[model samples]
Target: MKKKLWLTILVLLMGGVNLCHGQSLNTTAAEVADFDVQSATSNMQDLKSNLDEVVSQLYSLDEKERGTDNAISDKYRATRKEIVNVIQTINQTTDTIGEQLKKITTYKKLMLLTYKDIQASRSGMVDTKQYIEDFSNFIYKLDNKLYNENTNTIDDLKLMINSDNIPLTLANDSLVQSMILQLNDLMNNFQQNEETQLETIKKLNDLKTRTKDTIEQYQTEIEKLQQKKNYLLQFMKLYQNDTRQRQLTINNFFESTKGVYDRTVELVKDIKKWVYKVDFDMERKITALNELENDNEAYPLAWPLYPIEQIQTYFGDINFQTEYGVPHVGIQIKAGQWTPVYAARDGIVYFVADNDEIGINRAMIVHTDGYVTIYQYLKKTVIKPGDTVRRGQIIWYSWWEPGTRGAGFISKGANLTFEIFKDGIAMDPFEILDASIVKDKEALPDGYQIKYLRDKYARPIDITNLELMTGTTLAKRENQFLIKYGVGVYKQVAFREDAVKDTNIDKDMVICIAFAESTLGRYLSTNANIGNVGNNDRWDRVPFTSAYGWARAIPVTLNNAYLWAYHTINQLSRYGNKDGNIYASSPINWQTNVLKCLSQIKGYYIPEDFPFRTGPNPNINNPTPETITFGETLTQ
Candidate 1:
């Protein structure tokens, strides 16, 4: 028996060189066939459980076919039938693997789209929540601004009434005449109407309260939606895990075939070596051909400002001035006038200075990572020293000579000088800002919007709030203004665009109001009061703490008047006067003056005439363009 076994083994190695040698994965795939989901798990599990028995059956079939004596046809047929059974099981398992692959692919796409939807919805909800927050904040802000104006005016008016300024001097002008007539009327029926005016005050606060509730409704809905989105995302992740397990099972099924296939190839290789046909390491060579796919790495940074000049000044070396050798200390980023500069990183403002000598205003900030980001040539710095600035916060407005031909600019457009310092050494910002190293813009797959993980997760600690508003410190007031970036910043709200979108106020009205209130921001020249005026009646905006905050308050008050009093313009006369607000107090010449100011601003209505003054007629119940509430006209 030993002699027989040795001879058999030697023959096995020496013969069967004629077996198929050139094998392909596709050829093996043909043998295995497609997979189906149902019964697939059982099929693979059965094959795995009975693997040894299946192998023995296959060898028995081979031996029956290659036997020396007159073969027993019955035994051969039985052996063949047993081998066919094992093959059927394998085919069923392969078919199951195919089904799993298709299912996994479908699931992957579904999960990807679901995750993307969640991401998109979350981003949008965050923005909507902010709008709701702004609406809520605007209410108390409006109340505060209006209350201060009203109380201060009443105090002065009481003093004047007791003093000897009787008849109110030269009260012949139509506006003043109207006021005097109302004052005389009030003197007679003061007690009767005081209750009515107080009722009006209640309605004002009530209207704001209702608006606040409406905003809260939006908040509630967004929160619920956010929760639902999160749950769906979690379900998708679990489903993906299940699919990955199925994939591993399929790979296990593949491994079973690999062993048998390798044995067959080994026989061929032994024969080839005996014949000296070839000497290749087929396993290593074939394994090398399998390509491993890599997951994509996201681009980690972004451009500082959205809209900027195409050609950015290189960071390392540059000459801003050849003759003066101005030693360009940083990269110059060119953007148009009123283009707000955002904080590139979360930081605290350290040093702020207006260098009139160099015609440059700069704000220096120290970041949490010990890097210092310096912004130069700023038109204005909203935050003061020690104020924490959030990433993407609008810290400064671009310094640009609007309506003038200026020098030292690219394409005659002003540039913001940006620099980064680490360990007291200036570093090239392009090293971080440029996405080319991580992945070039063109290199990204088609229809892909690459977003940084950092961008998604990096959010600042909430320090921009009423908690900082002590109604005293200038820095604290400025901090409050800075927090309301979209509504109060120089660029985003340069013309108060955010408020205009959510209110009845228009750009034309803002320009006019700013001109009327602060002489178009000139009042801010001494203090931080913008486009405002106080005739000791109802125009002082002292409680706001900053010009930007004061400017934002204008729209809130106008919208409130539209909602509560149904009046479009300001009124100071008695309760029944529709045009009784401050706008009507300028002797009807107010419109002409407002027109002049509106025309001077960059974008506003022509100064041909004042459009919304329905003189002596109440402003409420009149839905005219530029005066009507946005709700009454086109919904913005």
Candidate 2:
């Protein structure tokens, strides 16, 4: 009966804990939703204000033009000047509207980023809540077990003390007193355990409450952004419509003014036909401005770094447009942290640190003829505004810490965001930048395109840059092949790095030959004979002390034995048939397998070896060249 009662209490406590978590989760979700609504409203208010300013300018222009029409007949000469003034005002207002639209677009992107932050925060909260729930459950189960056990022990001791029908001697009396003390101790321990559990639960509940409060603040921000976004959308629609109508009005006035101004010029010219005709230099400033604009195209910019590991993001990416409501304005070069950032062209520093509010540390260089290059997410800067820098000069260092304010949330690791702008409008950096330094660009065959063998091999698959690639990335790629094929010789060995460091042979050729020789050492004898050198008996094998020992020996063995026999796989296959200088029993088969593995290891995917499987799984004790033929090869 006592156990049944305790079980009922346990069930009630479990239900209470669950109820508390459920209520807290629901409240958090609601707050996040509310934040979105408020954010949208705020955006709308800003848009509405900008729209009003544009509309007012349009209205004032319309009134001015209308007034000029009213006095045209009575004061035709005086109205000519007024018409010129109205035309100039219209041009200025049009520029103003364009600037306003750019601001609205920027705000839209900010709101989208806010939404991403809210989602990340909510995910973190869910994880924290789950931890608290599990912790509470463990504590509750322990508490229930202790309570039941202690209660039964106390009841049994009481029954023992009450048992009678014997003399009350000193020994019996002392024994009863001892039983009473034991009961008291058990009760004290039970009470202490219960208190400890309560304290633990209390601490856990406090942690949960603190977590919720922090997220609540974030949710509040989200709500404001959501409301602003909604409000902005409404105003954007109104602004678009208003601007369209105003544009038409301004266009009509422009044409009207042009015709009137032409007639007025002709009338005045006849009246003062012989007046002093001094050639004015009115176009001097305009000519200078035009020259500056054209200069941007004449001189192309340089790449900030050579052999870039990857392009993280490109200009005008569709994904960027969907997330930010505007196309990306720059290219993000994936580079290592602290890598030097160079100036794209010869230019004066315009801004050493712009867009800091978004946590982007950047530098802008104003190049010749109105061209500007922006480098963002830099760790350190060495130049200040107004300092002139040459093309390819070091300007800053790259940043790559993820979750840091410096790198922002979207960009994960070390990268440089490079942008080119001509007269304040963003241009594609790839389109305008010079490509002389990127040798990999010209390495691909006419019809062939670059592709990754796997996402893990993050670098570009350019044979030219293969040796120049980072050693760690190269080693990781080589290790994958070794691990997958269960190659005993090259497993956990830096074969690629060592081969490149020790020999002049192609990295791909070395790895391919190893695969063709022994499935990358999987079938090698315990001696770790990678190349099967000096094993002329076909089934024979040479030995090395260790995998690294074999790695060091293969490059030397290849250079001495094979370099004279063949420089290329094609030549080697044809010559392999020669009696004494032969490298394989079936030259054609050897060539086919080597080339197949060669292409795969060089950033292309291929299926497993078929037909006669020489891999470790089939348990081939020894895989000879004659036994591993792809098929009956054609006689050449």
| Best-performing candidate as measured by lDDT | 2
lDDT of each: 0.40, 0.46
Error of 2 at 626 (Å): 68
- lDDT (tens digit, per residue) of candidate 1 on 1-636: 223432433443356211112111111121122223235445444434544554564455455444586454443354245334434434443454445544534433443454454445445544543443444344323322212333322244444543564344322233433544443343334333433433433343333333333333333323322322232233223323443553443343234223322433343344334321224443332233222111111222224453333334545444544522344445667766556666665555655665332123667665533366777656656677655554445666665531111111122246776777654556666555532212223433332214222322321211112122232433233333333322224423323544344544444465556555455554453355552332223443344565555566555445433332322222211211233234234443444445444333322222121222211122345534444322221111
Q: Which candidate is the best by TM-score?
A: 2
Name the weakest run of 10 consecutive residues (lDDT summed) in model 2: 610-619
Candidate 2 ranges with C-alpha deviation above 4 Å: 1-299, 354-358, 435-636
Candidate 2 residue lDDT tens string, 1-636: 445544644554465323222111222223322334345445434533554454464445445444545532223233233333333333343344344434434433443454455445445544544554454354444333323355543344443544462244324544544544543454355445444434433444343334434444433333333323333333223324453553543343233323322433333243233231224332343344344321222235667753454677877778866754455678878877556677766666655553232235666666654566777777667787656565545677676543233443334456787877775567877666533233344442232123212221332222323322222454455656666764433553434456545344455566766788778767776576654554554454556666656655544443442323223344344422343344455646676676566544444322111111111111123334432221112111
lDDT for position 20 in model 1: 16
> What TM value does model 1 have?
0.24
